[model samples]
Target: MTIAKGDKIPAGKLRTLTADGPKDITTDEIFAGKTVVLFGLPGAFTPTCSAKHLPGFIEKFDALKAKGVDTIACVSVNDAFVMGAWGKSQDAGDKVLMLADGNADFAKSLGLDADFSAYGMGTRSKRFSLVAKDGVVTEVNVEAQGAFEVSTADHVLGQL
Candidate 1:
């Protein structure tokens, strides 16, 4: 089932690129004892994801942090290298955590995985954003297919 408000985030290993190399970050390591804003997209560097979805969060990072959000993360079903490159290209800097769910484990756990074979993208996560406090989701906004309304940073900030 799609994860909802009040549900505990499921366990999974996501990859993050570091200077040393790709590192595995567990779900508990991310959400434990903190308020996190996590947004997932279909893929990195896609038109909408690069043009709007990711930029919205990057632009609103400070506002979201001021609202007591500890971490802002962007997850996609791509390898760490691609995620890292995308982050750098977008000038994400230290503002947003770029997570690589390369195997779609996290997306599947949340029931957010969708097949994009028609687009030649294979399986990917739906566009969505959520607020998790101390490991439990407090709010979730899942966008409709091909829509960008609910999961925008402005909408997520309004929920804060």
Candidate 2:
């Protein structure tokens, strides 16, 4: 079942890239008592994700933060190393939390997995974004393949 508005985030472990190395953080801890803006992409460094999707967030980080977003995260099925590298490549290293859902467990749990084995990328995350307050989702924007209609920072910022 797709996680919808009003749903509390499921508890799970996700890896975060830190200066000290990778750190395991619980989903609940991250979302608990905070307002977060999170977006998931199929993979790190993919064309759309690099060129536009993530840049949109990096560019508007301050505005989103001003609107009460405690954390702005970009997640993908890639591992911590890959996600870290991609963040550096995009010059977004300091701006966003680049989270790695290496196994797609989090995505699957949210019903956001997209199978792209045909394109040689196994299971991946559907392009989507959400706003959560104190662990409960308040707004969700999931996009169809190759579409960028709803997940833009501008759209979510407006929601806040």
- Candidate-wise lDDT, in order: 0.96, 0.93
Total clashing pairs in model 2: 0
Residue-level lDDT of model 1, residues 53-99, one tens digit each, is: 99999999999999999999999999999999999999999999999
Q: What is the lDDT of residue 40 in candidate 2?
A: 94
Local distance difference test, candidate 1: 0.96
Model 1, runs deviating above 4 Å? none
lDDT of 2: 0.93
Task: State candidate 1's TM-score.
Answer: 0.99
- TM-score to native of every candidate shown: 0.99, 0.97
